[model samples]
Target chain A: MIEIPYNVKPRQETGLYNAKLGIWLFLASEVMLFGGLFSAYVLLRVGSPVWPPGGEAQLNIPLATINTFNLILSSWTIVKSWIALKENDFKGFKTYMGITLLCSLIFLVIKYFEYSAKLHHGIFPSTDNFYGIYFTLTGLHGLHVIGGLIVNFYLWGPGKKMWKSEPERFTNRVEVSGLYWHFVDLVWIFLFPTLYLL
Target chain B: MSSQNLEHHKSIYLKVLLALFVLTVLTVAVSFFDFGSITLAILIGLTIAFIKGFLVAGNFMHLLDEVKPIYWLLALTVVFFFVLFFMPMLWEMNLVTVE
Candidate 1:
């Protein structure tokens, strides 16, 4: 049997499993990636004589707000799913994970309408600097949401088999996936205010 | 993995969820008010955002329970992130005037 190191126990020196450490490092890089774009946003807004440039190009605040709550609810559900797994409540885990996935799809669907609305109005990314950055930032974030949804879907579906065989490892896997899901939620937490409110 | 830890997380998760919801509403409410200065409005919005972000990261992501090396890594990332932000300031200063 090939041992998967630190799946259940922490390494003595760092007191973390391999997957936890790796996820944090990955999140740190994700921070830099979003950080760079955010810095660009700030600079562009500051340099522009008229920030947002056009009233017509303003984002749909109400829709974005709804999506914000959607992501937040998903965040809560993902954590709850992990908690269910920790308690060995497979049914509860599946229920919460299903809700989390539902929220993800709802968010993307709302985003789809929002984007289509912009396109219908002929608001392309090349419309202006504001739209340019708006599309770029939110587009990248939407991609992350899709990625997280795929992971959660797999775990909730096919990956449930791990529960019967290696429950502890299964729990760790959910925790790791939860970490990523929360990161995606956190990104939207910032992105919401930046693009919609401000 | 203990019962105590699980219970603790459950309580914290509920509290954090409530806080996040409250903060989201607060951000939206504040946006309606004219702070008299765009900069001031932006500042308040960003401050609220950072608070919400911290709550999610520290609680939901379990950053509060993470190890030292991870903190060190994040600290380093923060340093570089700020450096990247400030690099533009140097350009605006006209340190090297280019025709």
Candidate 2:
């Protein structure tokens, strides 16, 4: 069996563990991916005579506000989960990670409602330029949330077994996973205002 | 990474969580009042978003205490991100209007 280098220790050359550097590098790319679309949104909105087609008259604000809180809470819970692991409290780790998972689920369920309402109202991505970008930006974000949830869920469940064999490595995994969740939350922080308000 | 520091980290994390909650509410409330021009309103809204972004990145993501290479890499990322954001303004002269 081959053991992975820098799984638990910092690399001397870069001063970061393999997964840590890998995730941040990945996140930098993710930032640009979203940044490009956000640029498109700004260009479209700017050229249009009426941004948001009359200053936020459309779109569901209240539901979006709720989603904002949901993501924020999840961000906190994920950090708490990492902290719990750091403190060697398995039960606390499970509890916090579970809450983080639940919050993400709630966010998606509310998003499903918001999307269903729009479709019911005949507001498809093809409906107009505003709806087009709206669906594009948000749909891509929703997929990120789903992706983070998968990695987080894996860490929260079957991945916990590694705690006994290699506790520090497991905690480091949680930390890296927490960072990804926070990035997703950070995206929504900007997305909420850009889409639902202003 | 030290057991002795967990308590300190916990305190800071709780403070950050409260700050984030308050900022989220402020972002929602600010949208209700007209800040005069659309440009001004957007500036205010985006400013608040940026502040919230900083709090999450610094505290929740632990970027404040990240290693040197990671910081430089992120700094580079920020530069490119702004470049991407501003590139669209050049295209602003040509708007895509859908009827």
Best by lDDT: 1
Q: For each predicted model, how many residue pairs clash, with residues at least 3 apart or on different chains?
A: 0, 0
- Each model's DockQ score: 0.77, 0.76
Docking quality tier of model 1: medium
Worst 10 residues of 2 chain B by lDDT: B90-99
lDDT of each: 0.89, 0.87
On DockQ, the candidate that comes out on top is 1
lDDT of 2 by residue, A1-198 (tens): 999899899989988899899899999999999999998888888778876663544678889998998899999888898888777899999999999999999999999999999899887998777888889999999999999999999998988999999998999999888888898999999989988887
Interface RMSD of each: 1.1, 1.0
Residue-level lDDT of model 1, residues A171-198, one tens digit each, is 8989999998898998898888888888
Error of 1 at B85 (Å): 2.1
Candidate 2 residue pairs that clash = none
